[model samples]
Target: MSQKFPEVQGGGSLIIAWQVKEKNVLVVGGGERGIQVAAGRILHALNADARVTVVCPSSGLNDEVAFRIAEKQVSHIDRNFEPQDLDAADMVLCAVDDPEASTRVWKLCKERRIPANIADVPSECDFYFGSVHRDGPLQVMVSTNGNGPKMASIIRKKIAGTLPDNTGAAIENVGLLRKKLREVAPDLKDGAKRMKWMSRVCESWSLEDLVEMNEADMSQLLDYYKSGEVPSLKAIRDTQ
Candidate 1:
């Protein structure tokens, strides 16, 4: 609360937001921590439709996540890092526990004006990654804003349990309803209306409740979810 940058107040977690949406992220580390961070990078990138490139030496992980990154078409540099490694990066994460190396990466990023997060050293980070829970594309990132990572993580787990497993399935059916509504509802083209509909659907029909419904039921559900007017049929015909 006192600082401009988001950081875990206890100093273990740094809290900051990096726009991983459609932006490339470079995670530099090869240990278990590095692998953990890389997975988040991959999921966030997949959700945001972004690209990911992982940079690390081959010494750390006994597992195959490093291999998976290559197989997944995520860009990878399978060796030690150099200062030039950061120039083209949109966001940087120094996940190694080694202070000297992370410091080197952090300094270079700062000098080059790139955003970087230093793991194991919250005070050194520019941003913090929080615990998250997702329902289909309904993703929520929980943070103490860096004040309390444990608290943030606890809240995320609690929220996760409340979210039904079939929430993701219901989301897909709603996606179809939205596509059809976009065609029929011209007056509802307002951005606010559209966002409100999404929020309303999330609240009313609710992802948890819709899991039992089939496709036809979902479409009908969305219809009743929208305003009763349903726009003019002439509006639908005009484009044709």
Candidate 2:
């Protein structure tokens, strides 16, 4: 007999981390609010190596936008948005205050099957821009499914405060350890066994311990993995 999965029933937005690297993103607006959104998109593009273009009629730019432009991080077209602008865009952001213009962009995105977000107008958007918290490579985004952005911002701030400062470094160290472990041990070729071993290693070390680990400490960890000798909780805690 086949198993039946439960049907999902909700109006909530599906949160996901999109890979925008080396992709084209279009922002249709360069006003105050639009510039703010464009600034964020540009930063994301910089980190992900994506290409960004902002379409607006005004020469005036916010300080952030101006800096990114000067740094050659983003391109700007000084003109009103045209339907043809959506032609090679992987994603689009409609930040124009004009309802007609926003609707037009939204419709074009839908027709083209491109993901889009219309600033402050959730009804016309395929997605909402949520508040983000970053700790190195760890990124957390919070949203209220377009119902309450202010609330999302508040929650994101609270959550950000709870994260450890060395989260990014710790994650990188773990990646290196994982790579080393795979290379040294051919016996742990089974995916499940590898996962179990990783879980055990993580259980022995706290976030602080992982952050404090240097080259010598990583060498000791590799030794433990090879010898099949798990370090005591007290020994691990002492490093912190």
Give candidate 2's whole-model lDDT: 0.77
Number of colliding residue pairs in model 2: 0
Q: Please, what are the lDDT tens digits per residue for candidate 1 over residues 78-117? A: 7877877776788887666567888888888889888877
Best candidate per TM-score, number?
Answer: 2
- Model 1 TM-score, 2 decimals: 0.69
Question: TM-scores across all candidates?
Answer: 0.69, 0.85
Cα deviation in Å at residue 187, candidate 2?
8.8
Q: Lowest-lDDT window of 10 residues in candidate 1? A: 228-237
Clashing pairs in 2: none
Q: lDDT: which candidate is best?
A: 2
Indicate the worst ten consecutive residues by lDDT in candidate 2.
231-240
